[model samples]
Target chain A: MAGQSQQINISDLDVPQLADVRKQLEEELTHLTNSFSQLKQAQAKFRSCIDSVKEVAPQNQGKTILVPLTNSLYVPGKLSDLENVIVDIGTGYYVKKTRAEAVKHYEGKIDYIRTNLETLQETIQKKQDNMSVVASILQSKLQAQASDKANKD
Target chain B: MSLEARLQAASSEYARLQAELSAAVESRQRLDAQLSENELVKKEFAVLTPNNTVYKLIGPVLVRQDPADARATVDKRLEFIRSEIKRVEAQLTDYDARTEKKKDEVCLFCFPPLSRRAHPPLHRQLVQIQAQIQAQGQHTAAATAATA
Candidate 1:
């Protein structure tokens, strides 16, 4: 499918066909937009993880802290090991890494998300462009039809 | 069977196929997501030393795991997801083809093949028939006036 490229002239399509094309493009654009926002949220979560990892500094070692086991419940605990933190890589797997390694892991995730976001943005831009072109073509076809009716009358 | 019944059956089948296709696509997306996540974990494991501690979260408890074992588990997961994706993709293509065939059947039932070849679409033919009737009525009215 990727090897084949078909160029369609939108102006040649009748109003109903053009409408169908526009509807398809609109659906695709909405899906892409939803994905973009989801990716952004994921990136934000990763950034927060980096910040939380940074908070576990050497200076804060042995400091008393309130750990929330639940959203509304907090348990008082002492920071035992500041150097080693467990990082959840994904898919229910966690790895023990040093503070630096954890930060690097999050940064890597953030970078991956960033690249994906860039490509998604490009795709969204292209779809929006196609949508506008289709819209304009549809408008012109409707105008032409109306003028034809006026001429007949 | 009656044409109306056939058209109804075709349309209903098309709708069912469409629903199934969407479900398949949704699962495919989920599998793709899981695959990418496992791949990321595998990449992370690649850089880790043999001494690094790996833990698998079973329920709420974290169980210590050998790095080699964890990597093997991730590899197996990746393989499973890949196979599942392939299966879903095949099902999607099958659904796509079926839906298209059903759509064509519905269209055929809506405008029979014979009439489609001889005239315009059903709606356009209805308009033409209405115009001809009106024209005939006007002609008869004019003839009656002349005879009177």
Candidate 2:
């Protein structure tokens, strides 16, 4: 009993213990929700990368554009290389890829993040179900105790 | 050592172990992120043609690199990160076991069973004595009524 794992019924727990479990579940849910939002933000970033790659088409070659030297600094420059763009692969490495290839790379990243979001959503749903179950059981226990006290009085 | 001192020591040890374990876990998470990033780069490298160029960013410039050499570098990094993760995992498990043992020691010191049995709580003893006196008074009242 001391070393082995055993499942205990939540209904058997007193009010304070049930409240503790609820609090823990609430914390986990919030953490998972934060991760979900972060993943969504990443997906948005990848989508924007795809759009930026598409914007640099061959038709736009030799066009004068305001290039960003800094966040608030833009320098007027002519677009020279429309066929190949330097893609920032992870770990501070960049690869020179054609326009189509850059789009594909960003698409792949978006797909990976989508899969992760799905799994995270499923986990959050399961935790929510557990939370509701614990909450209902706690409510019923409290009501029973209240009625018992009333009858004794 | 006194029980209080032992409990204090055990609790402090547990806290230290917890801090170290969290640090190890954080590093493991960082390594995992690095591993995944490298793997993504490796995948991109796989689909590259010989004409495609790879560059490593240094300070402020991109230096052209041989695709094969870049692949090798990424592979080596992945291997290193994998090894680091394994070592950290082992450390985490060891810390987990140590913390569990320390927690048990602290609990034993806090609620020593022998001391509890030898000297039950004062309120409980008082309650037992009061019940015994009430029972005796009731018995004496019944005896007087019988004599009358």
Candidate 3:
């Protein structure tokens, strides 16, 4: 793919043709960069979530807690065993885990997301570099075309 | 094919790929957010004892749930989310590969294949440029207002 695009001699194209190509590159690059930032934002939120869970887990241990009965009501309750926990994974599903084990699970998720973010960042950089090269070639061609028009006139 | 016709075809394909990529990314993020929420709940559940009264929200009411039952439910949910995340990630990977392929085939110049990155339709570029100009103008106006 790289070889095919590189083979195009920019000097062979006229001003309008070069401009058309440059415009397309700019739009595509804009889209790529936009998505990259969005992915970064999601990763940051996930990290903060992990930190919050880690901070709150220890304090709740062995405590007789007030369970919520409704949106605004609470019922007093005590745990039979502090060592056990039921985690709602999603879509009304539940799972059991120890507090320490749950924290480790979240930490592992954070690590996985971090790795994904890193890979995406690398790809964004490569796309940006490719866009810049295209821009440079387009600019030079446009400049040369202007000079040719001036000489002819 | 004429340059105009070829440009139209490539631009349309690029536009399609752009939309597909955005949708895939959005879905992936949503799934990740759901997973994070579940993990946080699991932490809370961990500190709870088996004999603790757990309230499960059934419809508008918080129905009493057996701690054992709650644990099993959450276990199932966690498993489902794990599988879902894998599925969504695979879909995202597939979309990313297709987008990359499309980009590679798109050569910016008059080449047969448009470079994977460049060559939007002229009208679309004009509209984008105009929008940017309008946004810049608004930014300056807001800055002046702040100064005033």
Candidate 4:
């Protein structure tokens, strides 16, 4: 009978119930904070990649380069045609493109990610604000209850 | 909505947001890893000279490609990653907003931050419930007096 309904009145909750609610909110806050940091890290990495692509494009035409076999290893390589570009079209297929097309593609991608990052930042701020509000309300309510009990005693 | 319905809706919304956030974080990690790999490929392209052999995978076959072509493909991949990240992030943001609104709606009592004008229907519902409770209590008292 006690577990039949899930309705809860926050104002009517006793100390034990409030403590349970607080625990849940704290967990959610922790999860959101972790997600925010991870998103930030991803944004930073994306920005760095864009910058590197921009800087490395014009200067590398017809120059000797080493390709990475692994993170810490590389093999000797060179570009036979500066104008010809290979693009992977998924399913293990490759297509051809010009250097300009490649640059345009990455630039378009950068714009898309930038918009996404901005929206995500706003959401993160909202979550943070919500968490703080919840925490403060819970703190004051607990304190108020304690003082009420003291006055009566 | 009734309190029970409102509570259920809010809990569901919170759960959905949690799932969406988790998925977004997972996709971000995957995109970050792809970016790291492409960064290395871009580095390789920066130092490419004429006659350097670039191998590309075509249907499980490693075919030799021009260095320029390989770099273009790498750039395209990086851009694809960017698009994916954006899509996931947008979903995350949307879910976050919904979750925020649901949280506020459910905790209307704990956090009476909602203005009366903004929550007229809910305010009406609560007032109705309070009046009903008072009426029931008075009726019970009258019955007890009659029995005595």
Candidate 5:
């Protein structure tokens, strides 16, 4: 009968559920932190790329270098900071990236970064909101308990 | 004896204001459409090239221009975008200011924000005011659109 019947364990589920929420919020915080790491890496990549472009095409290099977006998504504030990190690999790399075969290779990495960023941002916002809600709930409950004690006294 | 004449004059003035509102709205719609088209063009340009790219796509872009001509075209387009943005912003500001003014003229008889006097037929007056508000909203939207 134990094998056939589904078990519905209800003991301390609500308290345990709160712990579960905390764990999820922590995970989300970690992911949000990852965005900073990616930004740093992107900055490094851009610096090296710009250096090489400056060597070959010094005059044109002084002007803005095209940072071709493989994935079309905008995360305004985060991406705006990313503007400083574009490294123009060189004319050869540019020509190769323009070539269909070479472009597809980088597309894989670009798509991953874009998707990761989107999820990370959303998780960060949601977790912060959840924490605020939980805090308010707790504050209200505490006030109610204190009021009950006062009434008895 | 000419009480009817006074009523006719008020109705005529009201009709004139309504017509002006509609014309303004139509003009705004046209402008809005133009702005939308321009925005689309800008997006397409950004995509075909790259963000923060120095050179924008010139339609059927003629290459190797005289330095002077190339510089002038670039300067002009940039100026155009700057001016267009400012113009739209100003129009929005004007609309906002006008709306705020209209709101301040709320019925003095009714307390709090929307005081429409406690007349016998409160419902009818409220309905008329509500309709006027909606029509004003449309008129504002149309005016802004015309500017676009």
Candidate 6:
């Protein structure tokens, strides 16, 4: 049957006719894009590729929770023990000033407080000295009175 | 219906919130500006306010009463009070000078001149002079009426 079909073709075709036939064959070989299954198949293939990536890569991770140690004194959002962090620092912000400038202001304040404390301490010391002197004087007076009494006896 | 519709709704909500935030920011800015203006005005008014020495002289300057027992309790409360009084007097003088210095700035606020305090020295002299003048005028008027 193959030999009979091959022998039936005559070699009488011209160049223009052969060219037209070749063009018609090419047009006929082109695929129709209106097929729904082709689109679905392409989509499935894309999804399979995504699934393969998911399997090879990582899975959906959950949120992380940070737990403090048992002896940890500080909680995440809790302030200081008896005061807030800012107030606990024992500093005040100056009016329309920077930290360094405010520190300079505090330097004067610290000096003033130190001076007052020293003066108070000194005055207290002086009072204590006066008290000791009076105590000695009173003790001597009592001794003198006792001696006088003994002499009279 | 779809993710795009949901996203569009979210975007619209976000935009509305953003607009509200912008309006709030503008209002805050306006309030801040108004507050600053008010402070400046107050400072200017205070500066322009005329200071009188009267307030200083109005108070008595009697000595603090001595403690009943200076030897007892070992406290320096009376001394501290006297010291505090002196410090306050000095501060009052300093503040009065400051007020006088700020008088020009206070003029922008446009207030009446502060009345003078009842200065003992000036008041005493005024009383004496007024009495003498009244007596002289009365004597002269009596003499004139007798002649007529």
What DockQ does each candidate score versus the true complex, computed on alpha carbons?
A: 0.28, 0.27, 0.08, 0.07, 0.01, 0.01
lDDT of candidate 5?
Answer: 0.45
Clashes of each: 0, 0, 19, 13, 10, 6
lDDT by residue (B1-148, candidate 3, tens digit) is: 9755655576567557666656656666677777776676665566665545566766755566676676676667778888987987787678767756655554442444434356566545534543443344333323222221
lDDT per residue, candidate 2, A1-153, as tens digits? 211257787788999767766776676677789989999999999999999999899788878899898999999998788888989988988999999988988998899999999988998998899899999999998999999999999
lDDT of 6 by residue, B15-61 (tens): 44434433433444444444443343233223221220111111333
Weakest ten-residue segment in model 3 chain B by summed lDDT: B139-148
lDDT of 2 by residue, B1-148 (tens): 8544554566667667666766666777788888988998898899998768999999989999989999999999999999998998899789768867865765555443435456566335434543443343333323222221
Q: TM-score of each candidate?
A: 0.83, 0.84, 0.45, 0.43, 0.30, 0.23
- Predicted candidate 4 versus true structure: per-residue lDDT over B28-108, tens digit per residue: 667777777686567656655564445678666768777677778878988998888788778767865775675566556
- Look at candidate 4 and tell me the lDDT of residue A7: 65
Kindly report which residue pairs in candidate 1 clash with one another: none
Model 4 complex DockQ against the native: 0.07
Off by over 4 Å in 3: A1-11, A58-94, B1-148
Global lDDT for candidate 3?
0.61
Q: Which docking band does candidate 4 fall into?
A: incorrect
Give the docking tier of candidate 1. acceptable
Q: How does each model score on lDDT? A: 0.77, 0.77, 0.61, 0.59, 0.45, 0.36
lDDT of 1 by residue, B3-84 (tens): 4456556566766776676677678767877888899899999999765699999999999998888889889988899999
lDDT of 6 by residue, A67-109 (tens): 3656765344321122101100111110222223333333434
Q: Please state the CAPRI-style docking class of candidate 2.
A: acceptable
Cα-based RMSD of the predictions, in order?
12.8, 14.5, 12.3, 16.7, 18.9, 54.5
Query: Model 5, residue A80: displacement in angstroms?
Result: 40
**lDDT: the better of candidates 4 and 5:** 4
lDDT tens per residue, model 5, A101-125:
2233334335545665676677668
Per-residue alpha-carbon lDDT of candidate 3 for residues A1-153, written as tens digits (9 for 90 to 100): 423656976557666655655555555556666766776776677567556555445456666678788999998886664564544444454445665655665566567667767876776687678667777877787677789899999
Q: Is the docking of candidate 5 incorrect, acceptable, medium or high quality?
A: incorrect
Q: Model 6: which residue pairs collide?
A: B47-B106, B48-B105, B48-B106, B48-B107, B49-B106, B54-B117
